[model samples]
Target chain A: MSRPTRTTEESIARVLPELDYSKIALSLVVMLFFAFFVSPIWTGLVTAFKTTGAVTATTPFVPVLPGTEGFTLAKWTRAIGYLSTGFVNSLAMTIPATIVSVFLGSTAAYGLTLVDWNERLQFGILILFIAGIFIPYQAVLVPLSDFWINLVPLVDILAPVWQLPFLEPDHARLLSLTITHVVYGIPLCMLLFRSYYLTLSDELVEAAKIDGATISRIYRRIILPLSKPMIGVVFIYQFTAIWNEFLFSLTLIGSSSSPAATVTLVLSGMGVDLSGIDFGFRMAGAFVAAMPTLIIYVLFAEQFARGLAEGNT
Target chain B: MAGSQDTATGSRTIGGGETDWRTRVETFSKSDFVRSFPYWFVPFSLVGMGVYGGIGWNTVISLTDYEGFDRPDYTNLDFSMYAQALSDPWVYLTAKNTLVLLIAFTTITLVLGLLLSILLDRGIRYKEKIQTIYLLPMALSFVVTAQFWLWMYNVNNGLVNAVVGVFGLGPFNWIGNPDLVLGAVIFALIWQYSGYAMVVFLAGLQAIPDDQFEAAHIDGAGVFKTYWRVIIPQLKSSSVSAAVVLMVFALKAFTFLYAMFGQYRVPKATDILATLMVREAFMLQHWAYAAAIGTILLVMALAVVAPYLWYQYGQGSL
Candidate 1:
């Protein structure tokens, strides 16, 4: 949809009247308002000090400050034992998936907007990508997962390069999950890139072409360099999305007792197995596992702002 | 190859024609490849074809009983799955919960985002820093935020209890008990998403000129009247934008619930449709039944959103 266009005269004339004060009073209620985000888990960071009795003693209440004045690393030590392998498993899933999806997504977007492809083919693929967004992952998970498991043999036979990184070939299960996540991310990546690309002058692209730059070379030498901000934004979006993914990892890795699981699957396992329901440790583990995403946010806030701003959703 | 050799022999430059022919062949191949990029790019369109085919198939899948690798018995399938999914007290309750969370989160996020945008617009000092800090959660994944909150919401050692301890209150069961689980999840959503909505509103607010506010000020227009009669109406698009996004997010929330509540949390209590479909169908392997729930969910989302989309389209056309 087009952005609504308003004339300056109309804009001023409309605002000729003032607004109500009480209408936005809640805005000024900083303590209570900010509390919405902060209050929910405000004391979680400090609660690392309390003994288990002191913890469970509160029943369901979270302590703003635990009774134990001194800190204890017991939870940390225990958490490592509980979730370390899971953390490695999750990383193994996220890192490669994030890299591949970002590459494929940008390529699709570039091809659609910058490179001239058949018009119907362009929209067809674009729509294909878009349509996947609305379909719940659950609807496709079963067939899709099975499709991945089934793909292992075919990939080995047809695309041997896929075998180089995938030595076991059985681990193609992870690659299957990766493909699905990548496929899901395609539309969004294309939408973001194409929108941003629209803002760039075609003269720039033509200029690069005049210098005898190959299509791929022009993309690397020119477009890629110019698109750093958007790249950062895409990176953050994909990083968080792929990193925090739960179900695929759970199904592929966690459900089996092959002594392997992604962090999400393990973290989920924590929730499942929690008879005492270790909220403190579980939450801690969740945060620790999610640290990479948090770090990306802190590091690249601007990229996220610009990138998400143009998200087609 | 022979024709190129004949041209080389006919070259007035004699034997040097061979070198020229080689160069000509090299340039021709290079240019031909360059000119043929449009063809080389065809394979990539497969991604789109794959996507579109997926859409068609998913639509069909939603309607059928084809569960994963299991052979489907579509003939036996009717509205049984859909009816059961809809009739299930849990589905109904979760639908209600979903609606409540959508409204609460959207309303809260929209209001706060609008206010934050306006506050920053009014030239709040350190505006940029606050904006970044606020937007930090938006950048963080839902899973990360959920996990972070899972820690923060921990009863025994959670920061909430620690803070409340001085006030002489016990730690509340944030994710554990069914009573507060929905609220906890909602809080998690707001924390992560409000900043996202705020940035959108802020961008819209930026596009709004200062002259309008100034004119309202000179006209004896109080802040409220200016905002109510002027600002609010103008922000209709932004409001719709925020509402639409928040609604979709609430509807699609899986990671948050799954991370916090686990798969089997009492179905009716905290189970959103997305999670319910997977929990029942995939986890429980109730293939036909889960497919039914998924179909219902697809219908529900479209039923709720399709109207708004059409309405937006009509308004845009006008």
Candidate 2:
């Protein structure tokens, strides 16, 4: 019986073909999906490398293969030179804002757990932070702009009387933008750290409590060390977010002629010229602007992906 | 000394030997509540004032008829801005566009993302590499995506036209034609966002047990049937979360369009409430009217979120 079964299996294997149409079709579908997602960026890269005249004349989808006349560094030079101020401004705004917001969020998250508050109050505050996640940035646009515009005059008036260094009118936009981003960042970072801390066992906190460590002491010594991974996660998340943020940057920091406007604003501003828009230069600038985040993403794709996924829930 | 001792002893005895109120107050200052309060105060107040407070202020501004380089008059408040917005023809057009974007973008992205997730989950070779490729665009700023797609959707020399022209189709105007601009914008947004939906759906798919697939196979179900009946139904939570995020982002498409066109005043065909709000406020200086539009948009956003919040509340995760 075993021999017959083996012979049957051998006969089936011999009769069947290796080639499968379904597999081919599925492979084609997946390939198409990938091509659909990748084509635009691939074209952007190709166009960025091409001369301005070549970009307009040649099909964007076609790559400038080696030994081609399409390649040019002119666009890159022009784009970088144009965007240098915005690049510096983005770094200036993003670095301090990201660090401060993440630090504030982590501390607040730790305090939230340690506070011996009423359950309803604690839950209410947590909900407030969560609710901030869904509030359309538009909802805040008018009032925030209103606040900043009004505060500038106050600063100018008070600076001379108080014998203090007044915020320069030009730097007002920068100050307001940094403050707005830092404040807006608190909710998401706090939520991320809160959820992260929730997963940790509190035996360490309890042990510290028995040793007469105060709430701040326990958090400083025990929770902070244990929270290194989460701190990195929150830091990367906030850094990416504040770095890429557009609407707030656009609304708050519009063309201050200083290190205030973000690279995104510069990239978008490139499109404003109706007749003289250079596709090569614009694409090159975009590639330049996106380089930092893209490099960070390549290095920490898993953590970035995980943080975003966890953040929404 | 005798008087102080008598008062302390009287209070202690009267309070059934518990510490007096003043001593309890001192001890409370050393408790976790006092220690932790200072830590939470700055973030909570800042977020509260910046976000919720802004919303409150926006609502107030919408109630007045303030516009064009003037402080909002706090004396008289009414819904005239909302009433005016309700009657405006532009408002109607933008509202229709917003609804179209929200529904169309969310549905298409969710379906495509689910398809990709299923394809990847079925033991595909180089799955990680493929996912990373699909997801790489998500890491890009909206400005980049907007500019990239603007170039791609160019009529004559764009890659989109280039690909289709090979099949004997002539180049079509993508961003130029009013009827096609919204679709083009939605397509670009979906391209940038579907990877996110796929990651979400993939996470959901992985959470299901393998025994369910074997059980379906044993029951003589085909590949399509197993996923359609057993697996896809289980992805409801993932779908809900992805849809909410997508729809919320759909409302935010103002930034994408503004970036693409490089101005607050986008094409009338593509203007959603967000773009309209910005244009009305900054360009035209119809501050109160813009605030009214913002209020409406907020209501729409909250409508999308209310159900999710209710679901979480029901689950006791609120």
Candidate 3:
């Protein structure tokens, strides 16, 4: 028994939708944009693995896989060796600064919501926190430096009288840098936490209040537990920011001999050579310095994107 | 005084002229200010002192001729620094550079980001993966991006020159040539932040209902026409928010440039008010002059922020 042959329209119908010219064009454009976006980092990564000679001699687009002079661990070792102290210092500052900022900011955001003050006073306080976001770091650069320097005198005067340990002015620079980062981070942290908290139902807060929970008690018991996602978002957000901060670190800490130098300062301190930059070493160091944020992005991309999107909105 | 205090307490007796003293105390304790004061105190004080107080102090320094000193001398207060900054050719050049960067970088990033977002929103496959690929750069630090771009923009063996060379374009000394430095830096910045703008625009695009597209199609509108007329207009808020953030970052590009060159002294071509401020204060010890420049930067930042705040207020979201 012979089967009827399919007509042109039937055959066409049997086939799945072919992407039209516009769709094909769109896919190409999208691919190109993504390619452009990914190229620099990919090049950096490839260069990081390459030997110095290969870095200068080879085409940048080629991945430096195993074999040839394309691959070497020398750059990574050297870069890490040079930047170890900087990594330590950055972590030392960023972890504490992130914690402090998140704590203060979350509390402040919670307070803003729970407070029963007059509308103007409440808005005024909220606005003050928001306004911090717009204050250029340059505005605070000179004054903050002076403030830290002069703080030593105040500390000296108080140490003997209050039986406190005295600190040298220069030694306090690291502390000042941490404080600056913490303070600067608060506005953003508070904004994120506040917006997130605003979305949560007030029933929990109301119930806590009715149950005679103190403000701190409410925050610790009800809000804090409920705020895990937001805390993660804020923590990562602030961590990434405080980790990458340069101006405050450079200005406040300068190029101190101690391990107080941040990763950014240390990486940046790897000044471009006049003859030729060791592209391999630079790329390796760049990759290492970027690892933490990159890890955060890879692992918690949703939270990161949400946090940033929330901040803008 | 003791008797009056006793009466004040007694006036709060059960069903009396007022509630009991205990009730009044309870009210006081329950007051929002008292209840929430501890929570608000630390952040408010720190931010107030660190930010607003710093601005005030900077203004004071700008009014005096404080230079090459640990402490700013407030003895002879005047606006000489401001006058000098206004008249200096360097300041004028820096200001112009700042404006150019602010306008050019923002407009380009926004347009690029909008295009990317629209493409992604139009039923792209592997949407999440593709979106993340575009967004990966935003998570990188300025130090990293600067370092990466330096190598990429190298005249020899750099990916940029190599890619362009294929199209028969000559190798461009992207960083060495003063004329190209600003553009190069701006391009790097766009690479880092256009993802940010895209994410914002994408969110705006997603919020728009699918019916809008269907309706536009029914009306015989092309995809481009639908996006231009029906979709882009709805992104006004997103565009504003993204623009404000981008512009502010542009003002703060001092750090990026400083990191790129590994010094306070960046190439003159890329000198914005921010880099100029840092270099003058830290490098040249022109404390008062830098302060004046800082004040101007603060004003520019405020100019960008004021409208956003006003918009939020209008939306009753403040």
Candidate 4:
């Protein structure tokens, strides 16, 4: 079926103007737009390699000429050194949060779909979850901060847990931020998972039930295997989201002074404090902070796009 | 055995009033709703307590004169903080900024994205690669983008100045100058999210059947006319969903501004309600006033989102 359609499309393409003037102009327009879109990233990449003196001495768009004093890795080294703690903190918070939220969200979505409950009640509950996606974090920020601050005493009460051989002092703040991400993240994850789950054939679920499969067994045997693609999409989406998050970390973990500062908070702090830092170091820090998401986007661009598109749907 | 007992009890319930309540309760316990409770209860409770509960707490705090670590006086709760906010000039200024940001950002991004999607839809080569290039920025943290743009907007030796210099424009202080700061911030935000709008529009464009385009062509309609008249009109839903998402992001532009300025007091020109709310609560310790401002921001966000939700629900896609 697709073969005949492909041939028709090819014939159409062949009959059309192969290299018309308008086509050339349109391509040029797109190229220029892409160039403008990528200029900042290009500037940051080139600037990251330039020496501090060269960064100020030359225009931002100019590349650092190799075999000259312009090029150096000193800035990268310093940035990594300064950002190491933040990198660890961010990973410690983001990984567990992403995993836990996706797990909870998937289970809830599966459960919501498996039952033959009242239609209006199900939708009302679905809206309750979906509404979280819209509630401006600002609405919850004051109480959220108060809640965390109040929990510090509880952390003290559980100090013995903190002193466990596996734990550190900063673990309290990291754990709190992780929990915050999970809480905020559940709605989005559930929305994505539920949308995917709804696409599933209800007869398959009914068959499993008739076969005496428990809810957990059906979920484990059927849904989990089919959910791989969706899990990828949601994982990438939530991972980048939690990693890129700033407000929650800034509000909950305080500042760079705190041992629990995420990479975003530290990077922002680096941008502000220009006392001895140069543009080279700042750009390097920005790139370093952005590397994980950038790598994910480069590797999984299709999944990333699908995640955004499906998220809105 | 349980099913037999249930039927027996159910029949008896129909004949006897005393057993009716107990049987109904038993049936309710065995219903799907109760059976599925284990799956959804955890997430439901977490979001309920974290999001809904926080909003409730925030609203309660807003009613009191809460500030500077003094415990809130719940006994004398009222709308005094809101009244104070109403009288404050900064509130109006930030509100104006927020509205401007919401409208300008959403409109420009939508148009630009629509244009890109249309252009790409014309069978452009290397389309996916180009789309990814455009979209790569959206994946980065706001702090990273803010820092990158801060450099790009630097008065001296920055790319913006360099490009404008060729056109004989003065090197503008994009960040420091109050008159230009809001526009500058909006432009950077557009840079980050226009790609997202483009992707959404692209999906919408792809969903348009090829027959529609051919039909328009056969009717002697030009490419521009075909899109402007038929294709674009069909994209109303796409435009709406993208616009709502963009508007919500605009309301959250506090992250970008805060990262750029690294302070609660962002420039007055660029201060939206988000920044104002944070400043009031965290910096000045005007907790109640900030909560009031947050409530107002929440209402504004809902004003933008509620219609979209309603539309989705009406479409049975909720």
Candidate 5:
């Protein structure tokens, strides 16, 4: 009944084994590396909260001084005010682009996976899509610019529609940006979805097929529902990529004016235009520009990690 | 199949061939190829036109001396742009820098990531929280990271210098010095992406069976020895995949440099083929020259990715 009168020291020893020097060393090393890894972000956080005077006066890693208007949301407000237009433009561009690309790419992946085609042909088609993922955007930049310029006339055909009350003038540029992102995004999205779709059991598709379900119907009823987790993964990955995209935005939309610029473009401009704005203000803008993706990462870290792991390998 | 064929022929004769044509049309429409056409063909064609067509057009432009605001002269074309690129010293320098960046960045990040992953795998507590902290940087845009590092590398009050100063080192111009610029850029990039490498390697590490570690331990191998011998060799595939991705990212690091300097003309010390290509085209309007450079960059990227694609293809994963 007394469990052989087990001693406290025996139980303690059972729970916590003898100390290992290597384990302790490993932990210490990891802790040090963590500090290095987080130092920039820590610095950014501190600097973003400091007053303009305190930012330059104090070390970057330190918090604001006691007497110097300790912490202010002024920088954040000012930064957001400057970036608000670009922020909206980015949302306008990123949202539709992500949805369209994901939808189309997923459908394409579904087709590739389930369609009865010649094996060589299917493999060939997949290689074609996979090749697109590796093509440096620089290779296509010149022609893409030319293509967009040529497309302006076609876009202008919608001028009457663009003149509607809710549409802004910058919507045209955003539309162009959206189209660019969608087209470029398709390959990646298709690759990711196709890989995920490949893992799904063939019996699920075959069972639906035997029940007189058309491919599209089966996709809508069964595949799409089953693909929710994958959709989430691809969505977060593409959203972050498209949101943080700079070259396409810079090359396609340019930093010409406020209304049409993406958040990355505007943030780059802020960094460049070192005029009256303080370091805190600029850092705040950078943080603001990065917020959506950061938030997505924080909330969907598992999906983000899954996406990275699956997408790469 | 026999019944359908019989019906097809019987209807062909009896219905004046009209019903047969309709039935044939219905049969063809129901074929797998036709049924799945919308799902695959539409997106495939779009990518084809956008990416392949763009590359084709860029190559055409590069063949011609297309500069300034004028339309590219398509009728007359030559290899003169490639010739010029080959002859230019700046091209050589930038190409060297690109190669250096590609190799150095990939190797170092992989090593650091490997180290981190190994440490992380060793029964660390709060593993998820620790990994998330390390990975948070990867979630940020290069624009944000560049800003953070710019401040970190600032000559006077920068965190890097501040820490170094504590060790009796003088404030150094990390961004300005030619010798330090590339290394500084590489360090910043490593800071951002080593976490990615770690995550990739961690997945690799976890996939190794625990029995392997137990076997190694039973064989009197130390922890370091077990990882070095029994564990790391199995991670070759992981390393290959990670290297391919990291190399691709290293090529695309034009965004980071662009954000850091906020200009096409970055510090000469850190100027890569990407920045140089953009500057030549957009700034100098050397469209043909830039197109040539872009083509070269594309070839370089393909060189890096081709083996990976082939491996995936060989594995029937494609």
Candidate 6:
């Protein structure tokens, strides 16, 4: 019986032939991508047009082709009308923080690349920064909040100079958020920028020096412009990252009274109804809130890929 | 044609300098030396603020002795709160949950990623397309992906249940049950993140010289034997990298878990230290105890990751 079974297996193998399993696997990958990647993305796109009821129907995504033009445009309306206000606040916070971090980070990277120091001190600091990237924000959550409170003095100093209204103690969470993202952004951002900048032709610097350009002027004139590709890469990524920023936003922003809150805060406002059902509104809210990041990604998709091909620093 | 003045320079021609081109150019006085204090800004202003902020915020909260919207008083520096936090109900459980999730996810991601990397490195056609597909999930924010996964894991109308039903099992409460929730969360994360690990491994694999493989092939070595002895050993750098990256990922595994399981009046069996810390300080307002818990987590992370970090960064691997 065993011999017959083996013979049968052999016969079947001979008849069908053992196909190139790699091709078969590739076919599977194509299928998975279509099924997993394409379908979800299209589903998400369609969801942006969906009214709340049509989305959570008995067959949820059935007839995903949309005859439900009752679409009432309410979700988009609410997203832009209400949430854009909060979004602007997020931008106000993120822009300065992002710009400050990129400049500060690239400068540090430049300095590190040029200076000679005790190997341990140099690399050890690099390690600290790298490790800092991995440190969970939660581990530092409590201390971070208290520290924000103490910034009243610094805010007081800035208050006299800039008269910035957001510097109030309760609203000081934005300052913390800005500083934290800067710290988080700096580690990898600087490393990548430095790595890319190191690839620059030293002749340029020598020429600049020959032209009698100061060190700071050389950085401003030569390095900054040359660093554009890396800077843009950092900006697009940092933009998406900061826009999606939630945890620190959720934790630091001390209740709702602190200016406008983040989109995550708005989404979390949907209380659980205990039906084991995904509260459709929250999903809808999330899709709406997440629109800007998605759009930014879509717009910058080409540049993002080029940056990836240029690859991790 | 007119006398060029470092004409190819990459700069914004400043307007504030000497008005006449030749007057500024003949002598060509360089910009005045500025005291490059921004060097200190990166540290003192940016990194220092965060570190000091973290240390100060936590210390003050720990001393405040507050608990959950109740008025917090900060008269003393006692650490009974630390003892209380350690012994708190569900704290040990949450810590265990975090470890299990971290270990399980890290192991799965590494193994699957390594396998995928090997397959990917086998001179396959359409490699770039395969990579792009694998990397698609990484583009989506966790906050968004969690919603999609939540839909897939929906008990009645979800994909997971439908598949399980086909296998003749009860519709398990994947997000509800204490014992199963953590595993489900870890599984989702592995699915979401393994591709990233695969990409890192692929880069590492490519860095291995082709001559090594050629030598093995020249020695009458078979495919499996060559891979076992030649390939896997060289994959260590990537392995360590994947481990560190995934460990960091595990430490901050919150968005999905939060989206899946909402509103914990108290910490749950699935609540990791991150969410636990948030709940304590944000939800419960137990500032002192929460600060203690936060410090413990920091110490734990530093204890393990610091030495490895020093090795990698010092060696210029990162």
**Of the candidates shown, which would achieve the greatest lDDT relative to the real structure?**
4
Let me know the DockQ for model 3. 0.43
lDDT of 3 by residue, A1-313 (tens): 0111122112222332443555577689988987899999998988889887788778886887787656898899998988888887788788999999999999999888754566688788898889898788898898887887675434354444434344344435566688788888899999999898889887877776666677778888888998899999999888998888888888877782455678888898774668768888988999889888999999988888888888865
lDDT of 2 by residue, B144-223 (tens): 88889988988878888887788988588988889889999989988988999999998888888777776766676656
In order, the interface RMSDs are 6.9, 7.8, 8.6, 3.4, 6.4, 9.4
What is the interface RMSD, in angstroms, for predicted model 4? 3.4
DockQ of 4: 0.55
TM-score of each: 0.77, 0.91, 0.91, 0.93, 0.93, 0.80
Native interface contacts kept by each candidate, as a fraction:
0.25, 0.63, 0.69, 0.68, 0.65, 0.26
Model 3 chain A scores worst on lDDT over the 10 consecutive residues at A1-10
TM-score of candidate 4 versus the correct structure, residues matched by position: 0.93
Descending-DockQ candidate ranking: 4, 5, 2, 3, 1, 6
Q: A161-232 in candidate 1: lDDT tens per residue?
A: 545652444455555666666666665666676677778888886776666566677678888888887777
For candidate 2 chain A, the 10 contiguous residues with the lowest summed lDDT are A1-10
CA shift at A183, candidate 1, in angstroms?
A: 1.3
lDDT of 6 at A128: 52
Go through the candidates in order and give each one's DockQ.
0.28, 0.43, 0.43, 0.55, 0.46, 0.19
Query: How do the residues B208-288 of candidate 4 rate in per-residue lDDT, one tens digit apiece?
Result: 777776676667666667788999999988999999999988887788999888788899999999999988988888888
> What does each candidate score in C-alpha RMSD?
7.3, 5.5, 5.9, 3.3, 4.4, 8.8
The better-scoring model by DockQ among 5 and 6 is 5
- DockQ for candidate 6, please give it: 0.19
Scoring only chain A, what TM-score does candidate 6 earn? Answer: 0.76
Model 1 lDDT tens row, B1-318: 333344546663655756777767755555523443543244245444444444444445545656645655546535656666667888787778777877888898888788777665554345676677677667544555666676666765666656677899876887677787777777677778877778887777776776677677667676667777777788777677567667777776787777665554443566777777777756676666765665666666566556655665567510
Per-residue C-alpha lDDT of model 3 across residues B1-318, encoded as one tens digit per residue: 233345555665545533665556656666667768889888999899989999999999999888886677899999888888888999889989999999999999999999888777766678888888998988888988888898888988888899889899969999999999999999899899998899899888878876666676667665566678888999998999899999998887877898788788889999899999988888888888889999999999999999899998898777
Compared with the true structure, what per-residue lDDT tens digits does model 4 show for residues A167-264? 76666777888999999999999989988988889998888877766667778899989999999999999999999999888887777767778999
Error of 5 at A268 (Å): 0.3
Say which prediction, candidate 4 or candidate 5, comes out ahead on DockQ: 4
Question: Model 5: runs farther than 4 Å from truth?
Answer: A1-18, A65-70, A152-155, A166-168, A274-277, B1-24
> Model 4: clashing residue pairs?
none
RMSD to native, candidate 1: 7.3
